[model samples]
Target: MGTTVETGPFGHLAEDLADLQLPTTDAEEWRYSRVADIDPTRFARAPVEPALESISTARATIDDLLGASTQPPSATVVVVDGSVSAAEAADPVRIDVHAVQTVQTEQASPNAFALLNERLCSAQVTVTVDAQARVVAPIVVASVVTTDGVVVAPRMRIELGANSEATLVEVHRSTGPSDSLVVPVTEVEVGRDATLRHVLIQDVSVRSDVVGSVTARVEASGTYDTWIAAIGGRYARTRVDCQLLGRGADARLVSLYAGGGDQMRDLRTFQDHLARDTTSELVFKGAVDGRAHAVYTGLIRIHPDARGANAEQSNRIMTLSDDAWAESVPNLEIENNDVRCAHASTVGPVDADQRFYLETRGVPTEVAERLIVAGFFDEVLDRCPVPGIAEAIRPTLAELMSGDRT
Candidate 1:
């Protein structure tokens, strides 16, 4: 193997990760994951700064990537191939490029991809909403990957000050059918009495793979709400860890995913209640078709000090074809008797009764199945934090059901 000559702010991380090995399915955290299939060394890292012509091209295509929307964003930050190409912000909000910072978390072990992202990312983008500020429009961050045979690491940090309220939209897309790797890491800090609504959309090429991580901390009386839509990629996986660190903190997570044609969608989540009166709720739904596979594993842990904590988790999946496969696992570890926690998971095909009802109502078999699938995801899509996300995804969902995804 050739040595990697590292350079940049995290250049020294190469030494620390020299002996570290990539995760395998043998580990519980990596079970059902395709980590063994990936060879990180085969892909080169993106340049520290993208070319001016590349930036112009990205600018021209940004609108098409984000889709048409009626409302203009309050702030916009565009990252092309892991480098910041354009950024603009409104009042009381700040956008920083190439900000060097390390995330501190106590709940999860060191993730190999996350560490690699920090070391190899061309730039780190930071968005901050000041205290007591209220932003009616959403702040949009678009991470675009356009090169093939390369690895792109995108890092994002969101900080909400006390008593502030804001909505953030993050979208990941690949401009071409590139066989590449994308490793992204996001860190969120919700301050006391703050409310932050976050939405993430992942729509990359089917020839590519993605490994992403999100870590968040909520302070006293703070609320953190997030929605995730995983619709594209050959093998797409995401892990989320949320810690309620102060009294009365609340966290809500919702996710929707669809897999087709040998694709795989894997999601893992951890809800940790460490303080008194903390609360959390999670709902994830997905469908697999045409020999595709889906996996959902989640855990809710209530610490001894987390008195009066309440937590709920639910994951449901539908298999559209006999060749498709899915797995759902939900667990709870409570150390406090005063806490209330419940978890439920189900893996099965579309409800026969619902399909029959639709068919008996004169709906065609294909149309009935499509309607059922759309209605199944409507529960989660209706709650999307972003305005146009649901509308944008409806057409894609229709195409997936019709096997027209290209």
Candidate 2:
């Protein structure tokens, strides 16, 4: 498995990553984020296993965070330090769970950090659903990293068969010192006429560093919808690449992010269209307060043959403090003329008119600000594929927003 001549899917990936340097802020994709916190060469390749006592405590913490009782998942896969602790699939939902040595990936990431993960990860969890099967309850996958001064890379692959439908709830959390790095890559393949709903919750602690990516390929008449609710981590960055590769495919991405108290939140997105009659839309709304920073860069590219493609990208951020900063860029490269496209970005303080109107109604200044911030995130929260995700985010958002929601 260590050599470049192995005949496997992930074979030669390490060789391809050999001699690659870590990306600095000078690179276009890494322009505004701090990557040093999670650099692979700066930390030990092997992570110290989390203690059983600590793991028991962490599992209890996760159960409370996800409200496992109310939103009881049909299947649950628990991953700790790059290994799966448990994979549970209930009755009536036909699904296959397995383990693999190395995963061959067709989507290559531009960042060396991701390749470093592929080179270092030890295990992965693979989930597959049969054709035409509908799994009503969601599948919950939790990833946790517990030791400091080390690297943990977790791999996940999801395969949905033709005309199948399901939902996945992914939670990433960490409890470590400042130098801990958790790099997790997830690959999803959606089959023809299938529907997949994905909800990603990044709820790490304030001292963890995370560089994560989700790559998905959608087939004809398939629908892939995703929503992200990020609230924790000291320096965090996530990327999403959606490839609409078949006719009548649709993809939608909606996210809500917040960074406070010197924390930094960065996100990158790409929507590449390769087939006709494909549609894609992305809406990201966030806030930065207490001298924090947030950065967003997105690209929408329509191939020459995708003449009937339609795509839109919108990113809006509210800077609640004078010390807060935000940067956003939306780009598009179209080789075809018969397509619909729109891109919008904004970073500013609360709207004067809205704030003033609330204050005119006798609302206090702090309360008015909270109300406005809550309203701004509501537009996308209303569209979350899993209602429980929005409910789960309220407490964190409220705490970060200064008692905004119940």
Cα TM-score per model: 0.94, 0.89
Clashes of each: 0, 1
For each of the candidates, the C-alpha root-mean-square deviation to the true structure, in angstroms, is: 4.3, 4.9
Q: In model 2, what is the error at residue 252, expressed in angstroms?
A: 0.7
> What are the runs in model 2 whose C-alpha is more than 4 Å off?
1-20, 45-49, 90-107, 175-179, 402-406
lDDT of 1 by residue, 11-65 (tens): 2333545665889999998899999988777776666566787676666555664
What value of lDDT does candidate 1 attain over all alpha carbons?
0.85
lDDT of each: 0.85, 0.78
Residue 85, candidate 1: C-alpha displacement in angstroms: 0.4
Error (Å) of candidate 1 at residue 23 is: 0.5
